[model samples]
Target: MSFASQAREEIARRSTVKACCVRAVCYGIACFAKYFDTKGLVLQTEQQHTAQYAQQMFACCGVEGTVVEKQRPSGILYEFSIREPEQVERMHALFGTTGNETSIQIDPALLRCRGCLSGYIGAAFLCSGTVTDPQKEYNLEFLTPRTNLARDFEALLAEHEFAPRRTRRRAVNVIYIKTSDQVEALLAFMGAEEAAAQIQRQKAVKSVRNRVNRHTNCETANLSKMAKANAQTLLAIRYLQQENALDSLPEPLRQAAAKRLEYPDLSLSALCGCFEPALSKSGLSNRMKKLEAAAAQLKQKREEACNEGDCTEQPAHRG
Candidate 1:
């Protein structure tokens, strides 16, 4: 089932309903229904729970309605109507509607307080609302062709400090909310506590996963940078050995060269850890720099001598 479907089902199946909110809920359903005019009242829905809820509402008010099942590509659809003259008139007067509604509008008189408004809006959502999965994205919206009803709904949301955005999708007015906090709060307000909890839980999981990925990426980059610097240090060490200049160096410099030769895989930072008293990275690094300078001087002199007397390319000294 969709996220919206689950939330709507939860809100619809609420049985311990307040008597006053029952009328508000029914009125919300009527205003957003297929039609609530002089002819009769028609409520079309795909949710069996919604049809049952509506039936329970009317039963409480001593009104009767009928439900007809229609076959559709998706599944069974329900068409509910109350065509009885007295029943239709009673339903309209319950919410202060004129019983000849040409343009649907929210009846402020029906919504006595925040609780009544929440129940009314919840029913209105059951009539024309959908929400995206919180794990994927945060989007909850109501779509209705009635412009006046949509405008009133927007105003209601704003009065309650909900930041709603409005747009037109073809012929319908789309009132959508994109923030997770607002979406979760609204769903909980409408009595879908479990669905709101899912949003909160998934948000925390995503945050932890993102932090782990960033830390792993940082370590990998540091390792890569260390490997490149070590390659240059290795080349200079091999050259000093070939020139037979390794034994002639200062003891600290000789030890630095010895460590690199023994632990060829270690970076300068790791190589520092192998010293008897544990050398600092800069201490080992300065030793390597001085050795490289000595090798460079010998290399320049060797190249000049080869130009004069044809000296041969010598093999690297492994020891």
Candidate 2:
């Protein structure tokens, strides 16, 4: 199951204080339900768990509501409605709503107590919240159809120092937390400790995986550069051999060239270890540069000789 669903199920299984449950149920209905002139309310959701949780909360609050199931092309939908005037009035009082309007607004009184605040946020999430897999990304958002409700919810999150961001996607308004720490805090606030821990674990794993990939890529690039340098060194050594100049080189430079040709794949540092009294990397590098210079001298002489031969082969110009 998805993390969002898991979180909702966790919230549903936990026991909440009566006052908290009543406030939560009121918030859930106000945010999710369609109202008819203060006399009736209707809530439709695809999640059976949310519907069941709402029913339990209403029962605990001594409010009467009906649960109905409908089949749609997408899936089964659970519908909860409160038509009794008395029950509607009680909900309206708890949420400070007029019930005549469809827009949702948070009443400061409903969130005065910490428990009540937590419950209301949790219930609002059950209605329209979703979280992306932490393994892939950090994103947790509440989706609402009403722009004013989304703005109010953003303000509520800000009051708690959550610093949520708001955006509109088509007809839906999204209030989202993109930082992993904030998402974790939201889960904890909603009383889903296990889900919060799971997100932490996933983040740790992702960080480790990224670190490993970067290290491996660095090592591979270093190896490639070392191989290219070794190939160029061998080509220079070949030039010395063709010119019969290897024997005239200084002993250390000749040794460096021979060792490099013998083990073409070894790095300069590794090649230093193969020497009889283990030369330092700088010592071996200096010797190799001298050999390359000798090879370059031979190439220049050969080019000059070719140019001279071409001039001599041409007929003398008439005076």
Return the top candidate by lDDT: 1
TM-scores, each model vs. reference: 0.84, 0.76
* Candidate 2 wrong stretches, greater than 4 Å: 64-66, 84-86, 89-104, 132-139, 145-148, 165-174, 177-184, 192-228, 297-319
Question: Residue by residue across 1-319, what tens digits does model 1's lDDT show?
Answer: 9888999998887653677787788888887788888867888899988887877777787778888888999899998888999887887677666676578878788888777788888888888888899878899998888999899999989889898888999999999999999999999988888999999898899899999999999989988888777777788889999778889888998899889989988888888899999999888889888878888888998899889876876658856
Residue 195's lDDT within candidate 1 is 93
lDDT of 1 at 283: 89
Write candidate 2's Cα lDDT for 1-319 as tens digits: 9888898888767778767656665675567554423876677888888777787787777777888899999999998788888988876775667766655666676665777778888888887788888877889999888887788889989999798999999988999999999999899888888999998888898899999999999999999998887788888999898778999988888889889889888999999999999999999988888888888888888788778884323457766
